[model samples]
Target: MKFILASASERRIELLSRVIKDFKVIPSDFDEQTIKFNGSVPEYVMKLSKAKAEAVSSATYAFSESDVTVIGCDTIVSIDNLILGKPKDKQDAFRMIKMLSGKVHSVYTGITIINVNFDIIKCDYACTKVKFSNLSNQDIEKYLCLEEYEDKAGAYGIQGYAGVFVEAIEGCFYNVVGLPLNKLNKMFGEMGINL
Candidate 1:
């Protein structure tokens, strides 16, 4: 079966490739910010993920690709009641880092798997509790200078230099990276698609 990933994230592509050798990366053009869940973090992500999957499915249908599965995912970091998306700019990056510094946050990733010929198969989301070590102003500044926060949720990359800031991770490490391997595999099993 052909597999298509509906995301622009190189990180998600790399991780998914580990399980399936042959898959296409067709980034969905859906505007995520337009989605309005207006509630909890998991609900918001799930709604966004569904929208993305629908977008890609429509696109794929236009192209008429049968016997294919499309997967769309979205990730977010939340602390307290605030949802932290990618930093708007450098100063914004600094501010997000400051909020996360010396505190624990939740990372939520929602994956939606769909096949044009069948019903949608999904593993809603995986939330990993991550604790950051107290960071000095210099640490935050230097991290911002590295520019790793440009396209990462919460203004930091758990797999990059920001790894230094992570004091603990309470769930799937891959979930924190943007995709949850265990949950994805289980979803595939439910769909009768095995790697």
Candidate 2:
């Protein structure tokens, strides 16, 4: 069986490579904005994950009838019932960082693995509560200056310079980074796919 990752995120590919040795990265052509956020954070992520998986599984350029498993994932940061997606611009990034400075936020990542032939789909999610240290204006300014917030949810990368801002994490560190590797391994094993 072939494994395909339906995401264009370099961070996701890097994280998956740490455990799985064989897989192809075929980013889905799905439009993320088409999915609406009208429910709980988990539900929102799950819906997007399924949408992304289906988009890749049905892609015209994708492998066909070859016993393939397509994996899709989405992550969001929720704070005070607000969902913070990728920043729109530098000003948006600054606002996100300012709001998250010394507060606790939840990071939720939804994962969907689809087997096209059997129509078997597995969906799950991981959540991590992260608390940031009190950040000064300089801290936010310095992080924004690095220009790494353009594509990251919540405008910060736990694995990058933003690590300094994270004072504590209550769940999977990898979840906060983007993908929850340990939980993903367990779920993959259940589907007879060894990492």
Give the per-residue lDDT of model 1 (tens digit) for 1-195.
678899979999999989999988889889886987586899999888878888887788777777879898999999997999999999999999999999999999998998866766574888999999999999999988899999999998799999999999999999999999998998888887887
lDDT of 1 at 55: 85
TM-score of each: 0.97, 0.95
What is each predicted model's overall lDDT from 0 to 1? Answer: 0.89, 0.89
Q: Note each model's CA RMSD in angstroms.
A: 1.1, 1.3
lDDT per residue for candidate 2 within 1-195, as digits (tens), equals: 778899989889999999878889989888989988896899999899999999988872344447888899999999998999999999999999999988999999999999877778999999999999999988899899999898999998998989989988999999888889988898888888777
**lDDT at residue 51 of model 2 (Cα atoms):** 94
State the local distance difference test value for candidate 1.
Answer: 0.89
Positional deviation of 186 in candidate 1, in angstroms?
0.8
Q: Over all chains combined, what TM-score does candidate 1 have?
A: 0.97
Best by TM-score: 1
List residue ranges in candidate 1 displaced over 4 A. none
